[model samples]
Target: MTPTALTPPLMTPAQRKLGMVLCLVTIVLAVLDMNIVSAATVPIVRDLDPVHGVDRLPWLVSAFALAATALLPLYGKLCDLYGAKRVLLGAVGTFLLGSGLCGAAQSMDQLIAFRALQGIGGGGLMSVTMVVVAHLKDPEDRGAGRGGAMGGIVAGLGMAIGPLVGALFTDHLSWRWIFYVNLPLGLLVLVGAALVLKLPATAGRRSLDFLGAALAAAFATTLLLVTEWGGKDYAWTSPEILGLAAVAVVTLVLFLWRQATAAEPVLPLSLFRIRVVRLGFAVQGLVGMGMTGSIMYVMLYLQIARDVAPTTASLYLIPMAAGMTAIGLLVGRLTSRGHSPRTFLVAGAACATLALVLLGLSGPTTGLWAVCAELALLGCGLGQLIGQLITLVQEAAPAHQLGVATTGIRFFQTLGSALGAALFGTLLARVFEAGEPGEPLGAVRSLAGAAREHALGSFTDAVDVVFLSAGGVLGLVLLLAVRLRATEAAAGVGEEDRPVLAA
Candidate 1:
């Protein structure tokens, strides 16, 4: 079926506004939870002091990320089977329930399990919100295009504010309040969605591809494990890491085969045949890696090398947040005017690469303002790319495949995040090991003289290497963006028509 036929009718202006608000609020909640815990980690570890050492602390974040990433495709399929509104409401409710449980947890194990539950809900919040926003638009109406950009802004804001919010809660009330804070905001979204969201109900029954879902989940989980553990917990060539890598490869191959053969695939293979859709996912993955990896390491550099407090380190992201928010809004407005998204994509990639290059050249003696300027440039570049890419994919997809197409992009981006963290972390670890020999960086911190200076210098060099590598990846993204047909504008397809791929 064509995309227009599958798209629901547009809502009235008031309803549309309310629906967009709900989508943005829910998305912020989901995105906020991902980063907010960063500042709270110390407090949580202190309070819950489980038997496992501090090494297990990473799981608090990883569990939520893994669950969210693994369940994205399934949530998309559910949105198609049920309605977006139903799936979204259920997701929000589940997230709130998990939040409550997390707030009350007295042990690390319970918190990890509850976070995973929250992540399952969080996954649906992101993918389904996009689906809902896509439906808010009439196929021919460019006016509704702002919804995509708004979503992008909300996501950026959530990421920007998470650490500051976490620090506030941890310092003033308790670490648990960070989770509790979601209750009121989430309830507001739930109420608004219930009152304002009006879409056609699911009229016919369709069989879900359970086997495809299971294989896809297994593949994603194993792949994440390989990335997370390869060089950190085990040697890259060690039996455990190698076995996980092998399993990931096998499961991914099987998942692809199943997609081609399944009656209703979790991720339809045909979607990749569309050039824009294919390239959009690729760009999203690369962007995810570069963007997230840079942000993470930058935070580390501030805290570790510069001795900035966690809350203050988060404040440095203000420039990035501003750049992204401003550029995203502009791109969204331009999209409504039928601009060539490829232009923005190419420009964004170029800017991002330049920003990374600047970051790589920065050092211990570099001025703080200069670094912040580069970060702003990085944010602007990413802001231009992200919202535009979402618009391109949604515009290119066939109506019936909208949810799948949206979720497919997110799935790759999430995978990119995992891969980026692992790859960058491994690179830093190897560099640190080579330079420091027997001493850990933590141990070096306790030294008072030349040992401390040498270790910090080594850490700085390692960070520079990561920045340079990330720059190289962004350079590749630039090439991919340039290859996309610049003539392909963000225009509407007819009810009976499918988007034409450029030759």
Candidate 2:
């Protein structure tokens, strides 16, 4: 069936506005939950005091990411099978339930379990929100102008505000308030969605790809475990890491084989045949790795090497956020006016690469203003790249497969984050250990002045290495962006469907 035939009618102005508002709200909450919790970790650890010690603290974050990443593909398929509204509402409700439970948890284990539940809902929120927004716009309105601007603003704002909001909750109220805060906002989103969202009815019953889902989940979980544990909890060459790697390889092969043969594959392999779609995923993955790794390492550099407070270090990111917000909105507007996305994509990649190179060359003697300016450039590149990529994928995908295609881009990005964390962490640890063997920086603070200087220098050197490596990755992204086709399409729904109107 043609995608246009499957699309419901365009939404009325009121319905479209309300629906977009609901999508934005849910996305902000989901993004906030990911970062806000980072600031509250110390308080959480003090209160729960897991018997295994603070070493297991990373699991609090990893558990959520693992569940969210593994379930994203499944959620996309479910949205297509049922309806976007139904699936989205379910996801919101589930996330709210998880948030409440997390706030009330009495043990570290319980908190981790609740986080995994939250991730299940969070995954759907991000994937379905984009699907909802795409459906809201008429094909004629899908150009880079307003559509691009809205998406860019949404992405930039949600990410930029997360850490700041988390810090606010942690400093002014109980750390638990971070989770509890979601309740009121999430309830509002749920009620609003129920009243305003209207999409096409399900076509018919289709068999679930249960086997494919299982294989895919297994593969994702194994890979996440390898990334999270290798070289930290266990040696890279240790039996545990090697065994998990083997399982990941085997499950991936099985998952691909099942997709090719399944009556209803969880992720349709045919989507990869589209040239733009294929390139989009690749560029998205690389950008994800570079962006995530750079953000993390920069924070560490500010806090450890530059002797800045955590809160102060976070404030320094303002310039980057500003650059991202401004450029993202501008590109969206420009693209809507019929400009080629490839232009923004290539330019953005170049900016991102240049920012990383600047950062790598910076030292303790470098001015703070200079660092902030470099970060702003990085933000501009990311803002343009991310916003345009979403538009391109949606434009390229068939309406029937819109949900899956959108979620697929997110899936690759999430995978890239996992890989980036693992890669950067390993590199930093090796460099630090080689320079200051058996002496952690925190432990050496009480030592003589000379020893302290040595520890600080080692950390600075490690940060430089990480930044240089990340810059190289962004350089590759620039090459990929240049190869992208400079085509434009106006995405819209057909007349067979009717727009939902306010009562």
Candidate 3:
């Protein structure tokens, strides 16, 4: 059941080398744009509309994140219909266009709109790159799922370094440079892809499921809005959030119905019947959920509690990035020696869980090195899980459904990240409030001496609770990962329970 090692026989060494570089660059452009703005928001607000921009700051992030997440399913279907090369090139062109627009924007409103446009293409960058990888794999590499393995490592590196990269750009040049940088990088890569990358076309022409795409988009949009706006912009029970939630529920039901009945469904419901497919989706979601606490909240802890500057706090992510990069490389080598991906999956969940527990136990007195160590451990777990799960599902997926299966992993993870942000954010606020009654979490910044110390302690405790809760979720992920059978033979032993592999 293990994927055999790949021999680089598909193309000349130079062509493969160039193609790989292009893939990595495209992926960085996509994933980095997701978080890079967080570090430069202050400068952006100051330059655009000092007073009003502060109020609308979150939209800078939400615009990209929401648009990117909502369009993922459609992008996958587009790849299937139009071929990955055509779709990927289009996405790059669109992204570059949006980046240029963003750089030239004179107002915050214009920037936000441009960001949405950027996300339209950014949506396809990460997911579609993997599809391209699948297409680019050698005939001998069939079922290796090694395609996503490198994707995971690069993605982890991108995520860890995003804020730091943003800070460096904003501090050294201009906030707009962050947007401008993508132009040259993307343009060069697009040209290289045109020349060096050779990929397969679609099996045949098929009708585009416009209605299914619309319904699915509606569901994802409303659900993301519910998560983003709830508790912060509006009360959970407020009409706006409630209205969005209702629409999300309604559209979800409709989307499911459409998937079941439509002849050319955008997302085929039958894919869920495959055991690895189902497990992969679920595991990726939980990983996203846990990441809200591990990645985002760690920055909060450093900046608010430890009084580190934002840029400096971002530097702290290096250990985690290093761990992800190191472990990811090691896994590729180990798997090449014919180890099952499940071995790493289970081990990764356990490692991440242990890391979360270590993070949860940290307090104000906890040394900075200790925190870094915990993060490294977490990264080790993530490196093992992120790409390996994709590889597993990819290897197991029926060839005809490759695009859908690939995108589904990312879709669930994005949705889970949204939900996790909402849940952990509320939990942190509530727990901190309980510790320091009638005090806002931000009040710790103003308090001095004893009061400040007390508030910081409370805030620390709240963060700890979040880490522990995330750890608990990873623990659940561990159990689920354990349920994953090592081989189709194991699953096929019971005909009634065996996964339906028919596309």
Which predicted model would earn the best lDDT?
3
- The TM-score values for the models, in the order shown, are 0.91, 0.91, 0.92
| Per-model lDDT | 0.81, 0.81, 0.83
For candidate 3, give the lDDT of residue 15.
76
Query: How do the residues 1-503 of candidate 2 rate in per-residue lDDT, one tens digit apiece?
Result: 53343234545777877787788788788768877887888888888984563876888998889898999888888877887888899999999999999999888989999999988888888788887777776546663434445555666676678777877888898888899999999999999988888777766756779889889889989998999899878999999999999999999999999999988888899877776778889988998899877899898889877778888998877788788789977886677677877788888889999999999898867888999999999989887777577777776766667778888888898888788989989898888889999986566445668887788888888888898899999899898777665422232232222222111
Q: lDDT (0-100) at residue 217 of candidate 3?
A: 87
Q: Write the per-residue lDDT of candidate 3 for residues 55-97, one digit (tens) a residue.
A: 9988888888888888888888887777777888988998999
lDDT of 1 at 356: 89
Error of 2 at 305 (Å): 1.6
RMSD of each: 3.3, 4.0, 3.6
Clashing pairs in 2: 9-497, 139-491, 139-492, 143-336, 144-335, 144-336, 145-335, 145-336, 149-332
* TM-score attained by model 2: 0.91
What stretches of model 3 exceed 4 Å from their correct place?
1-14, 143-145, 486-489, 492-503
Residue 287, model 3, lDDT: 89
